[model samples]
Structure formats: C-alpha cells, structure tokens
Target chain A: MITQKINKDNITTSGDTAHYTEGLQEEQYLTDLERQAIDHEVALVPYKSAAVIEALKIVQHHRRWISDDSLNAIAAYLQMSPAEVDSVATFYNLIFRKPVGRHVILVCDSISCYVMKYGDIYKALQEKLHIKFGETTSDQCYTLLPNCCLGCCDHAPAMMIDNDLYKDVTVDMLDRILQKYS
Target chain B: MERPLTQYIHPGCPPFDIREYEMTGGYSALQKVLKSMTPQEVQKLVQDSGLKGRGGAGFNTGMKWSFVPMGDSAPHPKYLIANADEMEPGTFKDRLLLEGNPHQLIEGMILAAYAIQADVSYIFLRWAYKKAAQLLRKSIHEAYAAGLLGKNILGSGFSLEMHLHTGVGRYMCGEETALLNALEGKRATPRAKPPFPQISGLYGKPTIVNNVETLCNLPHIVNNGAEWFKSLGNGSADSGTKLYGVSGKVNNPGCWELPMGVTVRELIEEHAGGMKNGYQLKGFLPGGASTDFLTAEHLDVKMDFASVTAAGSRLGTGTMVVMDDATCPVGFVHNLQHFFAQESCGWCTPCREGLPWVEKLLLSLEQGSGTTEDVELLQMHTQWLGPGNTFCALAPGAMEPLQSALKYFREDFEKHVALRRCPYQ
Candidate 1:
C-alpha cells in the first residue's frame, strides 16, 4: 500500500523515482513485525542509524541470514545506506551475511577450549556433519563455525546450537546434541 | 572466608526471584542508600571500600563513578551501563553472578545509578550468553513491576530505567568505549579517551560503564561500611572478595568467591583441586587469555592487582588458564593469538595489521617453519604493539601471552624449530 501510494505520485522525477523505489524496496523486504521491532530499537537510541546493528539482528532473527534485500530494507528503515549498514554488519563475527543451516553450530576455538582438546571435538563434528568450518551440511541440518570462548571455560570445549550452550562437549556426545537440534 | 559476592548465588538451581532476593538481604542496600545516604556519600563509601573493576582493568570503581559530572549541571539522562559482554576466554565469573541472582545485579545497578544519578541503565551483554540474557530480561521486568525501576525508584524521588542490550557477538565490545559505540548502534570499535565516558558517553551524556561484578559489589559496599568491605580482603591492600576461577586440565575446574589476595597455589591446589593426575602445572595465564603467563615459580604470588602486577602480570579477570606439561606452549599461545587477530576492530593500523602478522609468526613456529629471525620478529612485534602504540589496549593485550611465553617458554619455541615438528605432537 505504501509503495503503491509512492509510485502513483504525479510528479515523477528521477529523484522522486529513486525515493519511491527505495520505499517499494523497503516494503518488499520488511513485514509489519520486523518494522515494529526496528522501531523499538530506534526508540532506545538517539538517532535511527544508531539502531542499525540491532535492526540487522532483528531482521536476521526473522529471516535466518541477512540477504542483500534484507540488508537494504534494514538500511532504509534505520536511515542508513546499504554500504553503511554492511560496514557495521561485516565487523561482527556473529552476523550471518550468508545463509546458515537449520541449526548453526558455534564451536569454541579459544584458548581454554583448545587446551581441553577442542580439535578432537571439531574433528568429530566434521566427520559427523561432513562439513568444514563455515560450510552447511547438504541436508541443511547444521552450519559449522568456529567461535571464540562461549564463556564457560570451567566447562571447556563448549559449543552453542542456536541459543543453547553445550558445555564439556565430547566427541561421543556430538550425535545426541546434534540430533536434538534436527 | 567471606564470600560476600557468591553467598546467595546458588548454582544448579534457578536464580532467586525478587522475593527470594529480598528475603536474602538483596535490595536492602538500595533501600539503605535511598533512605539515608546521598549519592555522594554512596560514591564516597564505595571509593573508600577499595573495590576495583573485576573486568581485566582493576580501576577503582567508586573513583570511576566519581568522575561523572554531578549536580544539576551534569548531562541529563546520564547513563549507567553494566559491561556484561563477557567474551574474555577463561573469564566466566560474570556469567555466574549474572545467571545466579540477577536481582542482585539489578539491585546493584539501581544503587550505582542512584550514586551517579544516571537516568538510564543498560546491560550490554554479549550474544552467546543467551541464558543470562533470558534471566536478566525477566528480572528487569520484575524490577520495573516492583517500583525499583522505570520511575521514582523506590519512591526516593530518583528515577532509573534499566534495559538489556545484547551484542551481535563482538569481542571488541568488551572495551568500555567500544561498548558505548556498540550501544549507540555503530560497529563495536573503541573510542579515543580524553573526555572519558564519565563526562561524555552514551549519546554524548555522562555515562558510567561498570563491569557486571563491579556493579554487583555496589549494594554490598553501601549496606556494609567501607571498613567492613575493606576487611573482607585477605591481607592484600585491595578490598572485597573476588570470584576466582580455574580452567584447563585442573582436577576440578570451577570458579569460587575467595578473598582478593588468595595465592595462586590456593586457587590451583585447594580451590581447583590441583590439576589432573599426570599433568604438572607448567605455566598459567594468571587471568584470562589477555594476561601475561605466570609460571609455576609464581605460585605464591597473591592474586591482588598490585601483587600480581608486581609478579609481572595483571590479575586479569582472576581466572587462570592453567597450562600443563602435556600441552605445548607454542600451540597454546598460538590459539590465543589467532583469536586476538580475528577480533581486532580494524579501526587502528597496528592492531588490525600487527595482530595477524604475530599470529602468522606463531603459526609458523608451531608448524616448525619458524627461524631465529622469526622469533626475533615476534619479540619486535611485542615491543611495537606495547602500550601507547595502538589506538586501544587490544594489540598490547594480544602481545601479553606471546611476550611472557617467549620469556618463560623460550626453549619450547626453540624445540619446535630444532626438531622440525611440533614436539608435543
């Protein structure tokens, strides 16, 4: 509806075309809920662009990984250009620009985990999932990625499946943990 | 013996609700502060108590709060943020305090906010701490419902609003200035300090960013006298109890609330149950991964700020990653350097460029491809990336383990090159 209203404007200049085209693109990318969530974060900060990271996280949470269209929609919603938002997006490791699988497996590759033989666990994951780091399984069951400390150093060799943190993870336990996610 | 911090924090059980928290003398500090003491008095009390930040840097917490411009002239809607972005490896103390009794942290935040007269408060948590996030969200809502937050907190005529802002997984957000930048929705990059966060932070307003453990100490300092708080320290000049943790090959790896000056030996042998059966404690990172390595010879060194620093390493986060004889020092340090190289915010040239170079050097050594020249280059990079060289402490901190490892484990590096293979493998 917003895009149609903008497109039907009589004074269609090049600048106006670009403006309505952006509006239509934003309409194409965002649903009402995503827009509402972005608005909530915008209310927290001083400027709209200040919510760009939160806006990206919100959209990514809705649509699993941020596509170019999703990124542009967030850019338009937060009043930041796509390049500006992309700059912020690429800085953080967790923001998935590429598509991940049904479950994202973040394996701890930090010092403590390394000391406790996280390599063996990573190897076990590779054997079971048949995927390397940053690759998704063919069935889209999981995407394996190396992460820094999950902050459970006491229980080292930790991994997180989506929001759930798995501590003291061993080679044999991988199948059980992975099965629950699938 | 005084575990003031973890007394109410029971692990394996769900966190204490508001009622349970109050029953266990939780919000009593906030009530005490609002009823009798002024904000200055609270700040002074904390400063006198000798509480320093638990998040790596051991700056005096009250002194940090005192820097905020006070009275009607200060910036309005001044912010108080709890730096709950616990990404530091081997440093898992904050998550316990955050997950155990969240109301304790909330009550503490209210006390700290009241001290600095901050109108808004934020818990800038890291992304992976999902459980802590869920508990904090519910606890923040409970505080608002109970008149402890939102407006006219506890009817003291001072209002405080609390919100939880989860990061999108950036280690750079652990830096306070970077945290503020992240909170403002920019990339998590550190800001230059001149007008510190206390004067101008979080949307150009006076802000106080306290670590999770530091904020959790507020209510206790206010409820207990300065002398009482100081007395909690175990003979060290530093005050209050600290949450010390042990990771890696220890027979029992866990965190404990011990006095500030507990010896490294006590932490390893008594608390962490003396490393695994066959593994002798070769060396340890006295704090988190960022701190310098302390060898078995430094076992008697007290884990206080001054004592540990005097022993040639910061008592960073009070969580030691113990290295056993079974583990290879070259590989151990290499893993940490890899993390630092990837985490550099790229805002500065030295940290962004120098870290990956150092990482490559270590990787080469671990792979037995390094020479004497490569080892010399590692030494040069350490000096080049030392304090005042980079935009922030990230690069300097990255060098801590490498520099100290080179000093203590020089033979280990040499062994890899001489043998033409990693000795441990």
Candidate 2:
C-alpha cells in the first residue's frame, strides 16, 4: 500500500499516504481495491508521482475509463495537479481518457500487418460493428481503435480485445471472437 | 547449432516453469558470478565477448556497463532496466524471449544488475503484451520465493530489487532517455545526451537501460565465456546468435535464433520457408520499420550491424518486414510514415511537424493526388529530417524507409504521379 504518504488531514497527500488510506471514511471516489492496487504500484517506485502510469492503469483496470473525476482523484492522491496527471495520461496511446466499452479492440496497422491485409480485417470490423475507428458500439460492448504493432508481427493482422490477443485473425474469425466477448 | 537463448522454449506449450528452467541450467551463471567472479571480471568477459545489443542499436553491452559510476562512493540505488518496449513494427523477437522463458531473462537481468552494481531493476514492458505480463508476474513471484531475488541474493552480500513496470503505448520510450522521462511520471520526451542514462537517469540517479534481448545474452555469455559466444556468430567478429524474424508474404513467417552474421537470403528462404507461393520478393526492410528498405540485390548482405549499415540500412531488431511484388511500394511506405508520424511524441518541431508533413505527402502520392513537386518535397523531407535535425532519432528513423523506397521504387512513385492512380490498385 502507499503507506509512505499519510497526511494528518485524513486525505492522501503525496508524503503521507497512510493516514489518507486508513481514513477512507467518506472518500468514496477511489475504492478500497483501487486504492490498494495504486498503493502497491506506488510502493514499487521511489517517488509516489513516478507511479502515475501504474496508478492510472490500476484505476482504469477497475473502472473502464478515466473520467475527469477519476483523474482529479488520481491527481490529488499523487499530489500532482490534474493537468499534470492528464499531460502524462494523454501522452500515452493506451490510457483512454474517454469512456471505453467493456472490451476495446486494438487492431494493428503497422507495415507488417498492412502487408498482410490489415485493411480487410479493419473493413470487416467496421461493417460488423457499424462503427469506424475510435468509435464504440451502440451496446457499449466494443471499442474499435487502430493500434500500432501488437508485437506479434509474425502473426500479422493481430489484435487485442482487451488483454486476449487474437493472432492471425481473419475476417471470418471476427464473428467468433466477438461472440465470445458479449 | 546450439540455440542458447531459445533452445528450451517449446512453442504452443506454456513457457518453462521455474523448476523446468532450473533443471535446464538456468541461474547457473548467477551461481558462477556469485561464487568465483567480481563485477569487473563479469564486465570484462562480456566486453571481450563482442556481444552487441540485439535491440536495433548494436552497442557493445560490456562497454555500456563499464561507463557506470561504480565503487562504494558512487551513486546508490543504481538502476538496471530491461527495455522490453518492442514497438518497432515487424519486430517480435524480444516477445518470444519474454514469453517463452521468463527465468532466463530474470537471470540475465540479475547478471546485468550485478555487473553495474545496480540496486533496483525494472522490466519496462509495453502495454499490448498482456500475456507476457501475466507470465512475468508469476515468474517474478517464483524468483522471489526461490531466493533468487531481493536482499542478499544467494547470500552474496549483493542485494537488488526487481519490479515489472508496464508502459502504456509510447514508441518514444524505446529511446532510453525518453524511457527515463516516462518512468519519472512525465511525458515520453527524450533528454539531452552527455549526461546519458549511465550517469544520470531515472530520478537523476545512475542507471543502465538494456534491451530485453541484449540483457538475455548476459547469462549465456557468463556461462559459456567470451570465446565460446564469439564462435556462435556466423564467422563475423560479431559474437552471439541473433533472433532473426521474417514477416509479410512469407510461407512460414517466424523468428529463429541464427548465427549473428547469417545472410539475409538464409533468414528469408530457409528459416522463414521463403516468400508465399504467389508473392515474389520485391524489396524488404532488412530490419524493422526504422530501417531502410533493401532490395533483392542486397539479399546476400550479412544480417549483422556493420554489414547492414554498409548496405544503407540498419539491422534494427534483426526482423525483416518483406515487401512482395504484389504490394504497392507507395502504400507500404505511406503506412510506415503514418506509424512514425503518430508516434513522434511531438517533443520537437522537426519530428512533430516534419513527420506529419511527410505522411501527408506520401498519402497524396498513394491516393494519386500528388504532383511531381510533392515527390520533390518528400525528397527534401528525407534530407531535412536527417539525424540531429529532430529532438531524437524518431524523425530520422522515420525517413529511412521513405528515402530508400524512393531510391529503389522511384518508378512506382513516378507512375502514380503520371497515371494519377495507383497502378497496383
């Protein structure tokens, strides 16, 4: 846990996270699980702010996306300004600031995948989901986004629906894959 | 014939568990280092091994270690980072090592940390590698339990802590300085060199950041010694085997740990099972996206750092992304430029501004809307965005394929201009 920073004011300041974490009464924004996860990440690093990316990941893992309120809470917890946290958050492609669906499909669009008919998979997905890139489905089940290399170029046209990577994914495989999700 | 790095890795089956790893002689190097060697001896052996980094820039691994501020009065909490950010397009070699045998990498990291006298270490992995992440977490837990990590490892009086830090998607973090900035709870913009990561990095402390593959070679080098590792190379002074991969229209697109100086033809034909039946080879990015494209004429070029450099491209990640005859060169180059533009980090004007401009010009050519003047503009970009013009290597690396594409595939660009339509389309 972020037992390092526990301010006496009963709020999680950057220095004293213990009192703030212990005094969780009325602090309903970040859940006990979320706080605990963030604390674990914070403990790994020397500075609490250095845990911003990990903390963001933990919070986003629990909550589907990072909202303004969530970002503010993260900022307050890390003793960083909301803008500062957002600067770090927005710079990364994976940390979604907007609301995401239950599962986000990151389709690889790099050269290797492009050579292997990434366009075809992307087109088929657009038709199936009835949504273009960066759009969520009406049911909030899937968010389709164009991603860079998924690190499995050997199996080009690879993608990740949340954490499960669908490799050598074909247009025909899309239906089967989507069916498993929602 | 000995695939030291990947011999134990059996694909389809789960990666070697800790018990399996130990059974197969994992951590023997750590045991060796702890028992009979000093940190200097380990670094000297690696330096003599001629083992260069496998992550694109082939810098001498031992030489990199030697620059650290060592000794008792040196900086405390010295860091050793495993740069597992394998975002280079068409690059997946590191992923195999990261996923296939986590313990081998752990032992390699411990050796590297000990060589530099680092107190803390992190495996800075990319975000999309969720499977690798899970396996790594489990493996790390096992290492802790086995007493291979944490306080006074193997009772050698040398203590080090390890952590797995997953990066959220930023290609700039591939650069060590930018990786440092990102680790410091900031944007992934690179810092100036001279005060390099060896001296000041990661909270302004001494740090040594190495590629996952580079670090993976350490254990083997320590176990087998310098001469044995040198003999593993394909008869070029460049020692050790490299994980070379081929993607695109190849019949069997895969990665193999081959002798370092093996010919490109060998990697593309024998190991990757040659190109797909219909798709004849046109040209290829000898390495990953950042490398200049090498044509059929360059197939005989050795897949080593110097040879690839001599051929006007780099042995980046040692993974080839083939360009088949059927694929449009303009579209192919456009796709690459688009990736670079999207990932520029916008830290400096040249990269941030020049890359998007280059992508637009390529897009214009691909869509048949480009004039001959646009080609001239692109040619200008290739020069203007050369090294030292950008904040980092992002823009320069972005220009590699574009410049080479124009050289080898000029007809294609000119054809698009003359016809006002994609001939391939």
Candidate 3:
C-alpha cells in the first residue's frame, strides 16, 4: 500500500506555467501494489525527467495509460514532483491518456505505401467499420489507425491488424477480408 | 505460389551482386535507363509519376532530385545519400529493402546518382542495423566487382563510388541534417532548413538525401517506366507497392507487401487475421507512435499521407501500433511519453521539462489520484510546449498522439481524476 504520509517536498510548481502545481497527495491516488512497483522500478533509471518518463513507459505498457496513483508513486519513487512526470507524459505521442481498443490496426501510408495505394486500404476499413480514424466503434470492437512504414517495404501497401502482416491488398480482397472480422 | 521475399536472402551472406540480383531481374532498369532514355527523360518520368519521399518528410522525390543543378556548368562532386538510419519508432520498412535486396537499392542509387551527376554517395545507416550495414557494404563491393558501382557503367562514363557508414544510434540522427552531422562525426542535431540538403548538404556541398525505400524504387521505375509503376496502384500517378510492418494484438503479426489505398479493416481482418480471442479493438496509434491516435471510427480513413493528415494526423513512417480493449490509455500515453522524454536531446527546455511533467500528471491520473486540474494542466502544457519547442521533430512528433488523446479521450482522463483510480484497473 502507498504510505499515508504525502511528502510536501515532492510537490513543485510547473515550470512552463505558474497556474499549475505538481505533487498531489500520494496516498490519495496510489494503491499498495502500484506503490511497490514504482518503488522497485522508478529508482533504477536516471535522475532527469527523461528517466522518470522511461519508468512511466514501463507502467503505461502494463497499465495502458498513466494513472494518478501511479504518478504519485512514481514521483515518490523517483524523488521528483508529480508535475515533472505529467510533463513527460503529455509530450510524447506513443503514450495513451485514455483506454484503447482490444486490438490496434496499423496501416503503412508512408511514401512507398502511398505510391502503392494505402489510401484504398484506409477507405475499406472506414467503410467496413462505419467509423472514422481516431473514433472507436460504439460496441468497442475495433480501433483503426493509419501508421508509417513498419519496415516491410518489399511488400508495399501493407497494414498490420495487430501483429500479423497482410500484403498485396486490393479493394475486392479488402471486402472479403473485413467479412472475417464481422 | 511465388517465392516469398525472405527467400531471396542469401542465408548469412549479404546479397549484392548485379548478376546475382539480375537472376531476380536486377539492373534491368539500368538497361532500360541507359538504352531507352536520357537523364532528362528519366527525371521527367519520375516527376510525372508523383513519387514522394518515403522518409518522414513527404517531399516530391523527382522535385528533390531535379534541384541538383544538373547541367554542364553545375558544380563537381555532387553527393547522393541513402538515409538508412531507420530509427523512427514504428518504421522499419527500409531494413527489409536494404537487407533483402541490396542490389535493388544499389541500382536505384546508381540511377539517382546518374540523374543528378553525383560522383560520391554514402549509405548512412544506424549502428544497430549491423546486418543491413554489412549487407550494404558487401553489396557495394559486389557492385564494384560487377562493374556496377565504381568508375562507370555498362560504358556510361558516369562514375560513382558508394560507401556505407554506420550511425551511433541516436534517434535524432534520422533527421536528414542531423544524419549529415552524425555522418560528419558531430553531435546529431538538426540544422535549420532552406539551404535544404538538396542545395547545401554533406560537407556544405550539394547533396540529395533519399530514403532507402525511395531509392529502391528507382530500378523498378527505370525498368518498368514511371507510368507502369503509377498504374499499379489505384490508377493515381502515385501508384506503386509498399511494405508494412504490423504489430500489436492482431492474431498474425508480420510484414506485408501490398498496393496503396488499401483500408485498415482489410489489414486487420484479412492481412492480420483479426484480433486475438476474447479481446475487442480499442483506439490505435496510427503511423507509429509519433502520429495521432485513430479509433475504430476512422478505419476507413485512407492510409495515405494526405488522407491521414486530412483526418488530422500525419502519415509518419507508416507504422501502426494496435491497441486492444484491455489496454489503458493513460498508461499507454505515459509509456510513450517516457520514450520521448528519455530520447529528448536536452537541447530545448520545453521538451526536456514538459515531457516529464506530462508523464507525471498522466501517471497520477492513471493511479486514480489526479484532479480535473491535472488534465487541464496537461492540456496547457501540450499547448505551450508542443510547437516550436524542440530542436528536431522528436518532441513535436511525440506530442501528436498526446494532444489527440486529450481531444478524444477527455472523459477517460476526467474519470481518472474524479475517481482517483483507473476504472479499467
């Protein structure tokens, strides 16, 4: 369990803006298990905010998003302010601030993929799912995302549903493909 | 069935021979370029095809090549740089092209060099890509042996020498100017643009920095003609093939070759065999971790540079990281923020300080101890520090998904703040 005593020293003001303050009450947010994990892991990295960010990456990978308790626990573990961690989380695109779908679909639309017609693949998915990119299904069945190259250039115009690779796609093939998911 | 591209790998050996590659139809483009076309003709062909850069920036490839002062009065020692430092988080497309078909890249490089009158070229690869570097080096040697690399062609008098240099593994090095810095044995920070690589690159001389995959397309474009490649896609001038690496919760995860404009649903269902059992789809990071997040609703949004951006995110490196229902968004953002923070070069204050602060706030929310104020603070920080804050694209690219997450998943963040605990947990 997180300790009941919240350290005042861990609290600090946000650097970029005066309106914000860092370091909320640790106990108010963290569970005991999470505190233990933070204590064990956050200390292993460097002292810069970057190190804390790395530790948070570990937490997010497991939790899929950053939580208040995790932040406080991470702050305590890293001997830093909660605001510091917050700053790092908001700056990067890979981290998630909300829940995601059960499976993620990554489409390659880089220059090579673009030339090969990745746009068609994106259209097929939008039509089949009845949603736009960045919007979850009402039933929360799938989430569609366009992506850059996944290093599979020999097979141009490719997309990854989750981890699997699909190549040589066409509009007709795409129609038959989405049927499997339905 | 036709042989898989992987089968072309010569076991432990790096395949670089033109004859070896020609066994698979390599240099046919050079034959076509030399025999059937002039340099201006090839340039016109590429321009008409609308091929763009495969690197992070989507500049027109033909336009970039055309900038090289290519007349009898142009300066000497022009350079062609094959940017092989594939460090983008979700981008690994170049490695396959480099390792699998070194000769193709070599041919493309030669053709591009010939087009722009570049006498010297460098394949700037990341150090971690040891196999690719080795393969490219071996290929360069083989190309020389086969009279494809060194001093002149099948009697064309356009001599070019290729060298492979390994990067020290900094993500920033992937930036074209930064790569130049790293190549020149300096700290890898991106220089200001305008004297873009096309004009003042590589030792302050005229240079052309092309992505590995972009260069690989040359032979095909040269041999098949730009129109043929353009016709292969959706009849658009930008038509051609692309390779994609798919990862995350899908049943089958691997790389694939397909035509452009294919939809995300087909990729997940037919290509990736759909999501794993018992799990449902959630939002995903479209185009690697740098691009914005796209939920299921946007599945039909075309996976092209323009369309993806029109739908509000860049087609950055075309890497898609799938997210499943069981995943927590706060944790995910925190994780990605951690990467950006760790990767920050520390040259800029906003990225150095702002990224960690956001991570902290998200962490607090994730643990269920945050307030609505924390969410507001995150938004505030994202606004203040997102643009013009970093030295390179890393921090800005890092912020894309976070800003989008804030816009799309505000309720989830609020719930974490209100309840002080992750509902998913």
Candidate 4:
C-alpha cells in the first residue's frame, strides 16, 4: 500500500512545527526511509533538482504534510537549496506544505463540472463536512478543495479522494463515498 | 468511421501484459521498422501520411520531425517527449487511449524516436492521472522485458530509453516548452521560440514533443501505409479518424474515434444521442473549453481543423463542452476564468494580471453588479490578450470561449445587470 497509516500520536507531539529554530542539524530531520526514497528518485533523473517534486511527494507520503525541517532534509539530500525545493512544494497543486485532514477530497470545478450543477454537490459536501475549499474538518478526517478538471469530464461532477477517483457523483452519493474513506 | 486506431482497446482487458497485445499484432510496426526501413524512409512515410498533432495546436506531425538535426553533424543524444499532460477542461480522450492500450503508444514512441534519432524520451503525464500513470509504467517495463525498448530489438542496432515523468498539476506544462521546463524541475513557464524543442531541448539536445494521440497514430501509419491512413478521412483536408467526445447533459456523453470530418450535428444527435430531455443546447464550445462557442446554426460545420477554423473556431482536441438552455452562460465563463487565473504560471504581465481581472468582472456581472462598460471591456481585452500578444497559447486559448460568448450571449449579460441579480435565478 502506497499510503500507510501515519502515527498521529507521534505527529501531534513531535514539536516539529513548520517554523525552523537555530542550531538544528540537517541530519536530525529526515528519517532513514525518506532519505532512501528521495535517493532512489534522484538516481532516476538527469539533474538532482529534477527529482524535487517526486522527492517532496515521497516525504509527504510518509509525513502527511511537509514541515520546514522535513523540507530542508529533502533539499539537503537532493543537493538543491532549501528555498528551491520550497518553491516547487508551494507551486505544485498536490504537494501539501501545511497539515491536512487524513483524507483530501479534490472536487473538480471546471467547465464540465459547472454545467453539471457542481454547485449543488459542493454545497452538499460543505454542509456535511462543515468546511469549504482548503479547510480540514474539525475531526481532521477530510479536507475539501477545488481542483481543475480531473479529466473525467465524460463523468462530470467527478472527484478524487486521495488517488482513487469517484465519478458521476451526486449529493445523495457523497455520504456513502465519504464513508468508504474515513 | 473505421476504428483502426482504437482496435486494441478491449474495455476490461489488462493493459500491463504484452502477450494479449502481441497476439493481435501490437508491436508489429516496431518490428517491421527496425528490420526493414531506414530512419529516413520512416520519416518520409510519416510526412506523406500528413498526420497532424492531436494536441490543441494542429501542427503537422511529420513536418515537426523533419526540423530536428540528426547524424554526426547534429547534437548527440536527441530526445523525444510524448506530451501526455491532457488537462484541457473538455479533453479526456488521451486518458482513454492511455488507460486502454499502452503498447500502441510505446510502439508509436519507438517509431518517432527512430525517425528523429532520439535516444532518450519522456512521457510527461499529469499528476492527477494516478491510474493511467501506474498502467503506463508497467507497460513500459513490459516493453523493456520484451526488448522493444532499451538497447533494442530482434537484432536491430537502434536503442531508446523511455521514462514516465508526472507533472505536479500545472496546465501551462501542456504547452511544449513549458513542459520541458517543468521536466527539468524549474517553474512550469513557457520558453521563447526559435530555439525550438527540435533544435535545443531537454538538456540542450534536439527534442521532438508529440501529443499522446498524435504518437499513437504512428504504428498504424507504418503498418497500414500512408495511403490507407489518408483514405479514412471524410474530407480532403484532414486525414485519419479523431477521438471526439461530448459532455454536459447529453444522453450518451462519451468519446469515440470517428472519421476526421464528422459534422457537429452528427456528433450531438447521433453519437451522443442528442441532448438530454427538456434541455435544448443553448450554445456549445466546439472544441474543448478553450474554443469559440458555436450556436445551432453551425451544426453542419465539419469537425475538422480547417473546417472548424473556417466557421470561426479551431477544432481543439475535437472534444465539445455543451451548455444547455437552463444553464447560466455568464456563470460558466466566470468558472472558466477562475480556472485560467489560477493556472496562469504568472509568466507574462497580460496573462498573469489580465485573466484574474477579467474573472472578477465576470463574477460581478454574474452577480448583477456590472455596467454596459464591463461587456465592452471584456470584448476589448479578448483581442488584447489574443494569440500573438501572450507568451504562449494558454492566454489566447482562454479568450476563445469568452470572446465568442460576448458575441453570441450579450443579452444574457444584459439580463443579469438589468435585474441587479442573476435573471436565471
């Protein structure tokens, strides 16, 4: 399984907030698993920085979200500057720099979805989850976000929970779909 | 009408295994090309076939190959890239091709690599297509195991290495040069032309970037010959079949590889089984979200590049996004603008700043907070941010539906403002 259950107990009290403090060594940040995964992706690409996105994804996959320390570790491992890797992390839509809910639901809000009355579904999801775009639930179980076309326009009003796509979604179906995730 | 291109696509079949693919003559074109024809001969045959790029811009495919410098006089280690970042709003055909039969694309890439003498190639896929990405990786490895990739095949000296690189969700990366920048781990912004990908690309080596559907056509062109390919088109101007799709309130919303010049009327009424009950087609974006809106009058327009162009819209990706009478056109344009604004890589002044401003104006108009001046301003800005003005095609393409909406649906804009709220509401 690509997504292993991250230990929430360790995450909350790790004292690894996004803010960086002085005198923290680079080696103190990354785990052995993250270092190995980033190294594997770096070897596949021609340039060390070319693996930045994939490297960040590997880090996020394990950590749930990238903190400043984790970002520095990734940059140090790839031989890229910390700021260089941060720009990639922020610019790309998928990479989460801040904490997210356990499940991220990316709702498609482009032309096809709009024509299919995506507003109704969006309202339904917001009301049920008590969060709008970019907000995680109070329980930290789901984050609602608007995405561009997911290329499932043939089945308009589509969404993806993590990597799995749920198509032809309706307000009635949202409850059952969300049930499968959390 | 003949479905030669999508013949291997059996709906539920596993794509990772090459055995079923070879049983139905999958990589035979690669075998024939490697064993018999010279690289120059293969290039000539493709040129004769007149296959155009299936990406939004319909540039001639074989002509693109001819521009690359090859042999001892040229740069070493030329690269080939399969442009699989199909994120255009109304476009989903490439994903269908990718998920169905990947070997066809693999064989097509090998043929293109041989023609351009590219030793390294990359499939720049969009990150959201997680399933398609996984399937492509497995299929590529299967090809390598069978000796169809990496140092060659059945005693042939030609060698190529193909890699699958996923884009971290940027629409600008669909533009060829921007895609190159993204692959190199820089900001996904469009690069200047003249030092085109053919001459200088991907680590400063010559590169050829072909769309996924465009590359998928190669194996068929080689196996069946150029003449047979040309005979598939409904008109003289276009050749081969195209994968056309219809979305939004259609009874049968789907995509199919039909003849090149199929009429817009046939696509709506025949293929898509017409619009849904009680929902008359108000206006439709003829090709994806980035093309001009054509009304019921242009239903007879042939859905080919030149014909659609003659009717005042480009046949962009051959996929249509239909809007019904009940839907609000202003709100639709606002939704598209928001998308363009967010996706703007912030490369140029006009695209970065202008799109958001236009989107804000559209939002106000949709909320019944606009004057007549706003409509005129939108019309002017469409021409201002047109093709030659922007850094790349992204901004110009964004203007297509907006500009045409102003022309066809000016009354809808008036209704929202006149009522001080959405008249539809």
- On DockQ, the leading prediction is 1
Candidate 4 residues B310-388, lDDT tens each? 9999999998999999989999899888999999999899999999999999999988899888888999889888989
Q: Please, what are the lDDT tens digits per residue for candidate 3 over residues B81-118?
A: 99888866556667777777888888888888877878
Clashing pairs in 1: none
Query: Over the stretch B195-226, how does candidate 2's per-residue lDDT look in tens digits?
Result: 98899988989999999988888889988899
Q: Relative to the unseen true structure, what is the C-alpha lDDT of residue B346 in candidate 1, on a scale of 0 to 100? A: 90
lDDT of 3 by residue, A5-85 (tens): 544453444443222223345434555665565555434322333245445656765665666656655655555566766
Give lDDT per model, in order.
0.89, 0.89, 0.69, 0.87
Candidate 3's DockQ? 0.04
How well does candidate 2 reproduce the true complex, by DockQ?
0.75
**Against the true structure, what is each candidate's TM-score?**
0.96, 0.95, 0.68, 0.95
lDDT for B394 in candidate 4 is: 86
For every prediction, compared with the true complex, DockQ reads: 0.82, 0.75, 0.04, 0.66
- Residue B268, candidate 2: Cα error in Å is 1.2
Worst 10 residues of 1 chain B by lDDT: B1-10
Better of 1 and 4 by DockQ: 1
Tens-place lDDT per residue, model 1, B1-425, is 66778888778999998888888888899888899999999989988998999898999988999899999878798999999999998889999999998998898899899999999999998888889999999999988999989888778899998889989888899999999989887888899898899988999899999899998888888877899989989699999999999999999999999988999999999989997989899999999999999999999999999999999999999999999999999999999989999999999998999999999988998888988888889999999999999999999998999999999999999888888789999
Candidate 2 docking band: medium
Q: Fraction of reference contacts reproduced per prediction?
A: 0.96, 0.92, 0.05, 0.82
Mark the 10 consecutive residues where model 2 chain B has the least summed lDDT.
Answer: B233-242
